[model samples]
Target: MGAHRRKGDGAGTVPVGGGRDRYFDALRALALVRVVTYHAFGWAWAGLVFPSMGIMFALAGTLMARSLERPAVTVLRDRIRRLLPPFWFWGAFVVLAMLVHGWMPGWQIVYWVVPLGDPPGNAWGEQAWEVLWYLRTYLWFVLLSPPLLWLFRRAPVAVLGLSLAPVLVLTFVWQPPDDRFGTGLWDLSTYLCCWLVGFAHREGVLRRLPPVAVALLSVAALGYGGWYALAHQAEYGGYDLDDDPLAQAFWSAGFVTPLMYAKARFGFDLAGLARFRRLDRLVTVFNARAVTVYLWHEIALVLAVPLIDRCWEVPAFEAHLPLESQWFMFGVAWVLIGAFVLLCGWVEDVAARKPPRLVPGARPATPAARMAP
Candidate 1:
């Protein structure tokens, strides 16, 4: 999840420089690219390099804080409206596939509609729906934001430190039970600090902090998180942040703080992308249909394997193509991703109550001048 860009007045015009923060949009686009790439290749160091999930949650938290300026009920309604249509549309195919593969139905099927818990799925659909953990965690954050924001306003620094306590307790004292509810709590605790940092950014708390204090705090967090992951790699099987929630929480908190602080304190912006119109437009589209991209990317990668296998049957492709390469599969995945954007992405537009469009941010053509009779 990232900053939710509200639709401007124009129905189909490409998002330009005005009225939107291209910086956040660009961050989201890059984070998404990193997510897809990491999944495709399974690089161990990918999380350390970018910590995309932490960045995403922080961005979402910032946006949530901004939106909460309105009535809480209205904000919550609009947020859920924007999120669920794309999820429901995506879930229909996933759930159907699971049933066809003989997944027995339990009352837990209700979770699929609202996703309050882990939506039940069979082994076959595991790869596709595993990403739902983020949505579940995000939903929890959204539901809890009013109190969180109110609490933060009362004691900014203390609440921010206290937010990390759950993860520390989970790590040192008791582990979450191996159950759906426990899993949800673990996920929520892991990123809660990053989420609060977003609140700090929006409230100008980060901006007011001394740069040296920010740097020192960030470095210490990163150092401890990295050391913990490396030292405990044996227990978790690898230092992959996903495997170790404690490490992930600390690492992401460290990684995201400086970036958010910089942006909050300085006027760090990606407005320069306006000069490269095509690239800016691509970022705009990615941000516009971010949910669609995230929900469908796993399936796209899964399809890429079979599609590439078909290429091996063709003599010309077999001879000339690096068909066996993961890079090739990465290319195929994006091709499928682009196709999905065209096919299913329009649902996002409809969910936003905008005109359903083939391309979310394509520049509207100028109206032809009337010919004089």
Candidate 2:
């Protein structure tokens, strides 16, 4: 515990307070936009997003490792608060969208709240309760980190080495069963590996590697992910339903790790972007309310689809659009996404406001710190 605490202080370099990590927040914003564009356009135009999303998850894994320094219970409580409140609020928006569109009866509202809106024929229509997949998986990752850290104390390098070796072999060799949920739904297991990799990162395994090591690895991983997605586009559509275990393993081990390794070391650079501080501040506000944005974006999509149908002769957004007009679809999706982001931003304060600041002396922790004797 003592040494780990030092790691928490030393290995942990990011500052606290603003709850704003500009680079990482931009990553999240980028990933969500990619998801929106893909679902809107349904093609490889969003090729880069898959690896980008992996980077965000690995960074999250790092965040969980460091946050464990605080009382786990307090941290867990805040995690639930920050994640669920906005989810609940946006959930209501989804229900309202269904009601407005007359897609379902008003009395069936409870199903939406419970997140079991599986229609008889199409299960994918289940709205996933508005980006709750990431939140739920992230919560699981946070819950599981303490034990992973406990393992880190005994055999850090060997554990990572062995885990990576088998997964690598399996990724190139096996295709998972698509009919059943086993390999199809990698769930927390896949992302868990990435999270633990972050813990290994904190253990100083990665620091010893040369700068070009991760960069070269990132390029290799990106190439593999692109070719893999292209090879299986017919069966998997660039990804294996986000459920296939084997594909999930490839994503985490082959695709995700390289991105994490790259992102941690400033492997990429952006230039001439400094004149946009005001633009960045607005984006900062958008990120601060990220929970709200994730919650509402889907509902906005659901509503926008029908409204577009009423206004235009073309009723279909996903199925029958001309191949040449993909950019038009992309623009529409961004407009809807932007609208939802702003609407949710207005409601963010109500949900994401941290538990009231310690009112003077009545706060939970006292000012004086006593060393562990």
Candidate 3:
């Protein structure tokens, strides 16, 4: 949550000053926006829909790394409490909603309850379960963080550097054809790099890198990322972008880490140029509700899709008409907004707000206890 000291009087807008970590809010908002738009309109910006999560990994690492003074068990507990309950609620809701809508094959409630419904084999894989993958992946990362912290404390940069070679060798050079690689944890490697780099970012590593050097690296990565994009764009006859070698190159833990680090550390604070306080407040609101929005947004769309598909048709005079491309995109946007707002309002009181210890030596859900991500 980044340190912050509330300033000014109660009657006035809470000045987000005094070293408040607005960067995290900004980063989190980035992830939320990317995930929402990617799911709602995969074709809108298909090649670039890669999530801001790698940055999130970096942020989580930075946060966890900073909190290394705390017991590992405490870190695990707070993370679990922050992540789990909403998951239980929404995961269960998705299953029941599917049953009512006749989308599921049977009354198998455990699939949703156990957090195992969206396996790699599922039709849409984890995306079918919407935001559950974050839960699974994040929890896994948190559990692994203590050991990682030990290694990181020893030689943070070198360890992070070690990550890249393996990524290139496994995800690129050798290019395992099967989706699942050596370990079940392969998909998480790049994300972990981002997390660790975020830890590095916390130590002022990227800021120390000369701007020109970082710019050159950015240019090179972008070139690689672009080439990756062109070779794999789904719009140009491919079904998915993941198959492209260059795309794999672009997505490598190595490629993304420096770029993410550069952006996080070096992104200019031109946000002051934003025209209105409304816009600022709106962004903050989005950040506050990000988790709720992520969890329930698809459900909102699922509920609205059928009704909207049957009942509403955009008239020609309406902007971006004919219900495809931009208009379909806009409709999805509105649906997502409504869903996000409603869920945020309902869940604000409880989401990520775990109570104090109910017992000695016992904390709320800890480690990989409740989280999937």
**lDDT of every predicted structure (CA atoms):** 0.83, 0.50, 0.52
Models ranked on lDDT: 1, 3, 2
lDDT of 2 by residue, 1-373 (tens): 1000000000112324433455555555566565665555555444344643455566666676667778888766766556655556666655555556555545445433432231111123344343444554565666667777778758876665554444444455654443223221234444555666677555556665676765576466456645665567676544532423334444445556654555445533222233476656544544555555455555555665565555456556335654235565456656775676565554445444644321111214444543334
RMSD of 2: 10.8
Q: Sort the candidates on TM-score, descending order.
A: 1, 3, 2
TM-score of each: 0.94, 0.67, 0.70
Q: Give me the overall lDDT of model 1.
A: 0.83
Q: Is candidate 2 or candidate 3 better by TM-score?
A: 3
Clashes per candidate, residues 3 or more apart or on different chains: 0, 4, 11
**In order, what is each prediction's RMSD in angstroms?**
4.7, 10.8, 10.9
Name the runs in model 1 displaced over 4 angstroms.
1-18, 369-373
lDDT of 1 by residue, 1-373 (tens): 1111000000111122346677778778888898888889888688888888888888888888888889999988988888888889999999989889999879998888887788888889888988887777888889999999999999999998788899999888987777887788788888999999989998888999999999998998899889988999898778888777888888889999999998889967877989998998898888888888888999999999988999989999999999989999999999999999999999988888889999877776655634433
- In model 3, the worst 10-residue window by lDDT is 1-10
> Which lDDT tens digits does candidate 3 get at residues 266-339?
66343562455565555565655555676666655555555555434545424534443445645765666665
Stretches off by above 4 angstroms in model 3 are 1-19, 44-51, 99-131, 172-184, 232-275, 312-329, 344-349, 354-373
Let me know the TM-score candidate 2 reaches against the reference structure.
Answer: 0.67
Error of 2 at 225 (Å): 4.6
